[model samples]
Target: MLTTRPERWDRVVDAIIVGSGGAALTAATMAHDGGAEVLVLEKASLIGGTTAVSGGVVWLPGNHHMAEVGISDSREDALAYLRRLTCGHEHDPAVLETFVDTAPEVLSYLEANTPLRMQPVANFPDYFFAYDVPGKKSGGRSCEPLPYAVGDEIPEWRDRLVTRGTLMSLGSNTMLAEDFAEPTEELKAELARREAQDIRTKGAALIAMLFKGLLERGVELLLETPVRELIVVDGSVIGVRAEANGQSIFVAARKGVVLACGGYEWNKEMVRAFIGYEVQPLSPPNNVGDGLVMAMEAGAQLANMTSYFGQPAMFDPEISRDGELVPQFEWGRGAPGSLIVNRTGARFANEAMPYNDFPKAFGAYDATQNEFPNEGPGWMIFDQGVRDSTRILSMIPGRPTPDWVPVANSIRDLAALIGLDADTLEATVATFDENASQGRDPLFHRTELGLMAPGAVRPLNQGPFYAVVIWPGALGTNGGPRLDTNGQVRGYRTPVIDGLYAAGNTAASAYAWAYPGGGATIANGMVFGFRAGRHLAAQPARDI
Candidate 1:
């Protein structure tokens, strides 16, 4: 935090929003619409943050659109479900209640004030659908933006927007959240047509819709501009010190500075300090904790620093993103002929569980041994039957296995090659196969085979086994400065930092340790971003 103002202000606005993800952009729109001159600064050259490359679903319980999908939600029901999930965590009930109460309003605002037209993901089950948690519904709390044609609708911004990662695996095909079945010929044709028109779907669509609204409102957005510090005037945050074109630029924010720049997974030191474990992030490479550091420097109190939106991931050496080898999002772990085993070759978690909760099980600690027993280099073991029938990570059925992947003729040989105990590995497989063939997982109590198709469990009895080292990864870190109900950053010395606000992954997560549904991250960020924008806009402008 910079206590002294610059001699000359390079630019001034009513609100300066740091970062350009869904949360930042939502705040920008809200502040701009509230009659504040807003400026958005992005660290990456691309306009969309992690949200652009994500699935772009927004989880909002009690949303009006839930009725369209034959699901009903109430504030009480949403709270009950959230409270149950957060029972043992250090989550704030007030913040959770605020998110539950304000999320529906935020959804309505985005639909009404922006070009985003979201529809309920019909029949898309919540992450905890099979769990015995009360107030949990099978589906309908999640919503996704309708596909938007950025190339046609916003040609000027098309080249600058981030491409959707889902396109990488699906061959650029697009689908609505409701279209879960295998793509038919007609569906394929429609998707091809949409692609030809440069119509973006999922996260890109969500960003494009919000971005379009921002552009129409004449809100200024600067890409490749990263904020270095917050400029404090007296006790209030009055501006930001940013860098653009190799020059330091001081931009004054009359009302406030909203730090929505995302999480710090890419910063190795911060990751080691806060998350005490390795987390291969699946987000864009720009989230390096700029907002987090600045907020800390500004005397902000932190919470939930150890939590993240967890993902069980397998790194593919052949695959790279932004010039680094990123872990492939785990796509094959829950397949019929697959199981995840620890270094001792013992199966640990319910492989069919939601990605967030599934990875948490990997942290199973042994007090007597003084170590995390299920920690990484854990392998996702699969048989030739799965390889012949499913697409495992980057491997397509009938295609030769990538040379980087380890393969062997039997489970024992595979375990030997991966440094696991051959006897334990073989025995584990035998026990799993017997119970799986009987359509019961007595060990993990797994209820589903895979997300792609629900069917009876298939034993991994075939020879020529394969193993991929699975790591405890994350979509993004969800811990940082803690925020109050109004989205204002809390201070150690004061009740609230006068003009400092934060939202999204930069703030301690609203859900605490629980991932409620598919788009909960996006929804929580937007709700608080909306709240911050409105609250900041309503405040009297501070003098620089």
Candidate 2:
């Protein structure tokens, strides 16, 4: 934190927003609408953060759009569901209440202010829908931005998004939560039309719509400008010292600086220090906890430091970003003919569990053995039947196994190739096959056979088996500076940091370890961001 205020500021704005994801942009829009002069600074040359590459679904519990999909949600139901999910977890129940109360309103505001049109993801179930959980909707609580003809509105921003392609295995052709079933001729033609028009769907559409709103409001968004530190005056954050063109630029915030600079998943030091485990991040390389560091320097209290949105990630040599191999997030471990086994060739989890919940099994400790028995280097073992019917990483059905994936004609040979105990592996596969043939998973009691589609329980007896190493990965880290209901950053010594605020992955997640639905991350970040922006806009201008 910068203690001394600069005599002159390079630029002045009522609110200086850091990061350019859903959270940051939402705050910017809200602040701008609330009569504050907002300036958004992005560290990456691109505009969107992980939000751009995500599924772009927004979890709105009592959203108006739910009715369109024949789903009903009440505030009480929403609260009950969240409360049950977050029970015994390190989270603020009040924050969850606040989010439940504020989210629908924020969604309404966003729809009114931005060019975003939302629709329920068709038949998309909440992560815990199958569980006996109250307030869990089988579908419709999570909605996504409709396809937007972005090129028609902002042609200049067409090529500037971080990645038009999503982190999801379902390629760019599919919209939010749309399945990977073979497309009909009409659907293919529609997709072709969208491609020709440079129309974006899902996360891309969400960001483009928000960006369009910012552009319309004349909000000054500077790309490649990273805020280095906060300029504190009398224990309150008043401005920021940012870097641009290899020079330090001091920018004054009359109201406050909102840190929405995403999570620390990419920061190896911070990840090792805080998360205390290996986390393969699915987000952009720029999300290195800049806001968290600044908040820590400002004496901000941290919360939920060890929690993250976890997923089972598979390393695919063909996929990379920023010259680094980007692991493909795999949520289909429970697909028929597939199972993940530890180094001992033992299956350890109900592989059909939610992606966020699945990695918890990876960290399961064997107290007797005094080690993490399930902590990977685990292998996702599958058969040619799966390869011929389902998609795994870049491997499409009917396509030859990618050389990167280890394959063998027998389960014992596959185990040998992947350094697993051949006898144990063969026995595990045999038992699984027998149980699967009986249409039962007595050991794990897995009810769901697939993630996106309903899969039949099939025996993995086909030859040419394949294996890929599975590791703990994440969409992003969801822990950092704690924020109050108003989205004001809480200080260690003070009740609140008067002017400093945080939202998104930069702030501790309100949901804690409970990931309610598909777009919980974006939804949680956006709600607080809206709150922060509204609160920041209402603040009186401070003196330099």
Candidate 3:
């Protein structure tokens, strides 16, 4: 276990932040910069939570850097995109406006105040059905952090900075699977070294840079500190009772308490009860909805409790020693050569869809077939060409892989090995190969037809086929305690609960239907966190 010195006495800060992910850090930084003394509490030994384990990209429309690169986007276009994505969900219009309007400001602030850097990845595509909207630039306005270094500024935080070796990375576009597939051996070697050294890649790296800036600004970090309960006096939240190092510590927040503790992705009971599906989570194991519980207990009204984002994951009943199922993204979905199939041995969705949408599609497939939602594992079928050409991102325990599977001579044999229907599997492969030949996928419209072999017109013609069982997994649960446009929690028949705020995945998302692009979750988190901080900092402590 990790150790930290408990500070003596009873001093109050302007804001108390729980969780150390991008949301928590961003909120803390904004509050501190706004002239409020801020204290950040994390449950893990390190600062970065799930954000550290993610691709460090933020989907910001009309960002300054995008304009600097000659990619012109207007607030109208962004609003159109969001409206198409949300499709009449019960979202606050002000919150949506604030997200787009303040995204560039937040991007600018991070670039100026933090060690994080930004570059636009103009090639990434939005996950929405490509035909639904026009003028939606195929990968127009996403930003990745620059390579940030710890640089001996905070020796105490050296090991605590979630780096790449922890299966995470900070800034740098090359960490993305799309970028990682570069054929250059030198680039591959560099990535390997960076991963070994725990150098944070994408989101993790960006968050680490933010954390470095926070440390430089004399921000205090309290880790392994779980906020046990909220101290609600009268109608406002005043403080938090946290368990730090086996001792109960009452930390007063004069300005407010921002709950960024993330969602209960790993809490199986919560997942089944709230999300109505069985899921293996790809998020950090530590997210358990502590903030949601604390705030709900204090009478915060919850919204959108039934919705959750899902992804495809390879499943192994006993992949982890702790008996927890693991979700593998890079190996199962990101690999270029693989394709997913349902129990009837039919491809269900576009393999290239964003990870979150894959499982949603799977859920649809399950509903169509009258099967248990996400209970029946899907199959990921690939060929030797994929095994030879693609790189498998390391699989964590509990996620299934083909490492133990035997290569089969034909589709029929492969289906037999995996217990799939031989004729159905053959028909599915034939249609896919035919569609690939015509440079079109009629079923799912998967782009990137080149991954399929030329002249291999049917599944029966392929040799040494491979298959792995997959299941519905999630990055994190998206629904939680509902907050107003200002990140203030709403109480029972009350306006705004002052001094109590929530952001990140812990708060209900404004996006109700489709995720627009990559890095959207982090973007939402950072935007709301900053919004909460600024709003709270401007308020009087007594009112809070």
Cα-based RMSD of the predictions, in order? 1.9, 1.9, 5.2
Best by lDDT: 2
Expressed as tens digits, the lDDT of each residue in 24-60 for candidate 3 is 8999899998888899988898778988867778888
Deviation from native of the Cα of residue 179 in model 3, angstroms: 3.4
- Candidates' C-alpha lDDT: 0.85, 0.86, 0.72
lDDT leaderboard ranking = 2, 1, 3
Q: Which scores greater on lDDT, model 1 or model 2? A: 2
TM-score, one value per model: 0.96, 0.96, 0.86
Q: Per-residue alpha-carbon lDDT of model 2 for 147-225, expressed as tens digits?
A: 8887688998877874375566666846855555567897888888988888888788888999999999999999999
Return whichever of 1 and 3 wins on lDDT. 1
lDDT (C-alpha) at residue 142 in model 2: 89
**Model 1, C-alpha of 490: deviation from truth (Å):** 0.7
Candidate 3 TM-score, true structure as reference = 0.86
- Stretches of candidate 3 off by over 4 Å are 1-11, 125-129, 165-200, 315-325, 330-338, 365-375, 392-403, 433-439, 447-460
lDDT-superior candidate, 2 or 3: 2
Task: State candidate 2's TM-score.
Answer: 0.96
